[model samples]
Target: MMDFPLKPVDHRVLLPVMMILNGVSLATAINLVVSLDPEDKITSKRGSALTLLGFIYFMSLSEILNMTALYTGLGHRYRNKFRLNSGDVLDITNKFVSAVQAAFSCVTGAIVCLWSCTRDFMRTSHYMSEAYAWFGAAYFFYDIWSMYIVHLKMYSKRRPFKNGSTLLSSGDGASVKKPDTSFLAYCKHEPVILMHHLFIGGFGFLVIVYLRGDLGDCTFGFVYLMELSTPFVSARGILSRLKLKSSRLYLINGLLMLATFFVCRVISLPYVCYLYSKVIGSSYIDAVKSLPTGCKISISILLLPQLYWFYLMCSGALKMLLPSSAALSAGDAKRRS
Candidate 1:
């Protein structure tokens, strides 16, 4: 009999779940994008909304890639079991390549951010507006590159058969050795870790976008800084799991809540800023009105890299958190039996 049953509720189940989430996010983004009033020059409110919507789109796309990766990764693990001809070796290779590409894209994003910041700083106040425009453009290009890399990785992992036979083949001309399916089984039952990471990464990217002035007019750099701290918070949870201790889970949860608070606050800052500026004086209103329509286009263009990063982090977090519960339970039952 097969040692590891091919259960229906394996990692494969996550694909549809992620797909549904992606659909929802996509719809939200499209709605937000369509709602923009063309008559109004792009204000901070519009820019912020666009940035959030763009990030949502990026998240959706990343989740799709992540689902594909998880499917292939789990499939490779399964093939390793029962000495079957698992065509997952290539998939694994593709995933690694994808990781490398993602890293490169991140580096590129960082560079672009630095360059824009530098240019803006060098320019006088007269050029401040133009500087912001340039930064937005840079961000957009960076995001496109990052998104393309993600798509490439997902596409590369599609063909599993080629890798399964060539790389996963056992040396003895027998089927490959089965892996301890328990690992994947364990993953399904404990998906919180993944979710936490996703939230942090997604929020972190938003913070970065906000920093680049691509999101809104609010100078909420502090909030962005707070959101950026999420990875460290999640790292604590990972450490707890590795050490087999639940002592830090509460602390991690606290941090997650704090991060969520910041995310919401930061997202809402545009409206807050608008209200504040309106109350301050007509000067602010005139200044906002003076911004060219191209500024909005620039911000949208530049915010893409940050959006991609946010999506990557969110997708990675989800992958880490949600494990295949059925697979885990089956393994446990088999071991106990």
Candidate 2:
């Protein structure tokens, strides 16, 4: 099963889930590109070096942005609501950052992807791709760090510390010293999401930026748009926290989330494949058959998780959208049994 960190999410952490995911992704992307052979046309060793610097700079900046949002007003307001536990402060911060990122990504994607035409989707990487791609990468570098903080804080809240003692939980309910609150623990709680970020952060960079021989950067731009649904996802979680589930605004957000998730993520792979087939002058079926096995595998690796999330979303939506059935057969039967 896919575990997503959302409602009843992290309490006190530095950045949001997606921001952490974004930071880690940005750093990984830069490092991956830097390690590649310098024969590539898209980036040079020096350029990669410069981008690394930018990555670090941006990672710090992302935290500042997150902290600014949290410590000032929003965090305090959200934290006080819980009264007993403040761990949710971090979780709220995490969501705020994710929403911000989604907004930035949507704009960035549109500015770059729609600047020209779809013909260049697989054959151009000159302007915006070259200029802003690295900036996008920096976001990942910051987000990975953010994800860890929230996860750790949330873990601490879940298990709690014994005054001055170092007792903690290893995320599996077992007690340990200070807990495993390391990257490994974060990975355990958010494995699928972390992997999704990692794949996009590391390998996706190669395909979108480097492997195209400096072409189709616009396609890379489209990847940003894939995050279009992220804000809604974060918003949904926030509204849930606010206990606004039945509000009309919540309902609207949920519907938009479903639409965007379906359009941007669920069918994104097939749409890409369709575009690829069109580019190659072949039917979609033939194109799929002709694609390298590795490509097919990569697509599957990205697609399946999305489908799983969509399934979970639909199920959750049904529960949320429909009126409660107090006398559910399962509830009655379980009581009787």
Candidate 3:
């Protein structure tokens, strides 16, 4: 949906534009922090402000680091993981930026989850902590959109995945390879990511407006779970870039990712369903009925996608755990013969 315009452009334009957008995002974050009212009752006051500031600052720093790494290849020194040749600079940078964003998001989410669970556990309906979550979501919306656009442009060029071949290269000369696939195949895989961003962005906006930065602690808890698997996801990317996917570390990280996704996203869905139902049953009019149509829809829409994503996660976990299933079957057939 975001790629409506298929016009061609010089790849040279992308780098500067991306940098400017990142700068704009940084400016927006600073503005929000500067405009924050210390005496505001809608927030946890100093705590919320500090959290928001930290998140924004970290995000800005990530953006700057991404720009510098992409432009100057400064990231190559970080164990020399990335391969930034003339042919794949933009694509590689996009992946690097996303990995960084995901890592930071995971950290921020962990902090929010801990803070909310510990300090404001009892306050489940209306309180100030929601603001912090909302603020983070707002930043995430822009971040997702920006990356989506960059990748969309980068993926615009067609490739032949069907005729693709993989080679084994070793020693210090090893480099990461981009997947060989048509734009359509890329499109097919990307919607889930784009949709996730869209939903979260919309949900965040609604939370800011109708909920007024207060979903109580309970609802906010489930929402925060969305980021629980992010660090593992990011780690997998970093490891892949470093060409460690076949190592024990990659396997361990993959296992952790699977477990975290199951615990955070899969298990939390049913629990949230139960909790939301209970809330509606307790005060139907005040909680459910009073909500705007969009807000109600946003909350309801979160469950189905999450359930589907969990199913995908489970399928992936099975495949990862049983990576030699085909080989085992072949061995069994040979023995029988």
Candidate 4:
């Protein structure tokens, strides 16, 4: 068992999971590469295979490193100098892991999107698109599993933190601890986080499964755009963990978050949907309708949370920018006096 949020996780479980995902990802890549048509020159096939294989290898290795950092608490040093409670430490670590994932997503997702966009869909290379989608599927599968594990711990029946001691010592020779409470109490402030994770993860898996071949390049471009706001989300987390809520950095990040959320998630997704609709609505497609309505509906439904979240993010930012309730109340008291 892992220690109270701060202790090392059970490597037995962790290592095996990483190994399995890596093995499966690599195997899939190899299979796809090997299945290339015989008509192509052997030399060209070899070059293409090696390129795809290299990407798969890099993606796997990057995942391994990311997971390792999270499980091992590799960057706890940055949390030093601040007196964080156990709850704060846990929250910060959670966000830190998210930041790492977001960073990866922004990088690789951008690459995938750029690569896809450079190719004309009518002339899109099927093998290249499959390679990207397959690799993305593997990564998101692992990500969702990891998120579910964390969600279970957070939402479990019992309190998830260490008992007997309110303080957990960090590597920086400082001890910080906070009182633990039940999940219901914990989620009172931000109840949507878990649901957001579940929905996003669910749809991501769906895209991997059913739409990988049909809509790989298009969906991927749309998907990667959603990650544009994630880095800002992660930054907000880091600032919150360090108790920098009143700082300018937090304020700036919040504004950036709103802009990116609107541009990337709120706007970009619907644009992709519009393009999808345009394709399906065209005169040529009227002769034979192959695109399913349900898939379109599902993709549209994914935008619902984005709208809600953007609202919340904007509201929060405005609230922060405005006078505090306490401040307003204090002024009222002074005027009355």
Model 3, 57-109: lDDT tens per residue? 44544444444444443544542444433223333444555555555455445
What lDDT does the true structure give each of the candidates?
0.40, 0.65, 0.55, 0.57
Location of the lowest summed lDDT over 10 successive residues in candidate 3: 1-10
What TM-score does prediction 4 earn? 0.60
List TM-scores for all candidates, in order. Answer: 0.26, 0.73, 0.58, 0.60
Candidate 3 vs candidate 4: which has greater TM-score?
4
Pick the lDDT winner.
2
Model 2, stretches more than 4 Å misplaced?
Answer: 1-62, 65-78, 81-85, 120-122, 158-179
Give the per-residue lDDT digits (tens) of candidate 4, residues 1-337. 1223323555446656766766775676567656665212223344445445544554455445444544444444444557644344445445554565455556555655565555553223334333444344344444444444444454343333455434445679786664344445545544566455555555654454344454446456567557778878978977987889999899989989989889988988656655555655664344124456766566667778888888888788777887688589899999999
Any idea what lDDT model 4 has?
0.57
lDDT of 3: 0.55
Each candidate's number of clashing pairs is: 18, 23, 3, 2
Model 3 stretches with alpha carbons more than 4 Å out = 1-63, 73-130, 149-189, 211-215, 273-300, 330-337
**Candidate 1's residue-wise lDDT over 1-337, tens digit each?**
0112234466467557657765775466346434533212344564555455444444444445544533466644644452323123223322333343233333333433343333332121221222223222333333433433433343343334644522244678776643323434434543443333333344334434343343332232222222343344344433443343334564455456445534533333344335445544546556456545754453344344345545655654554455576568789999999
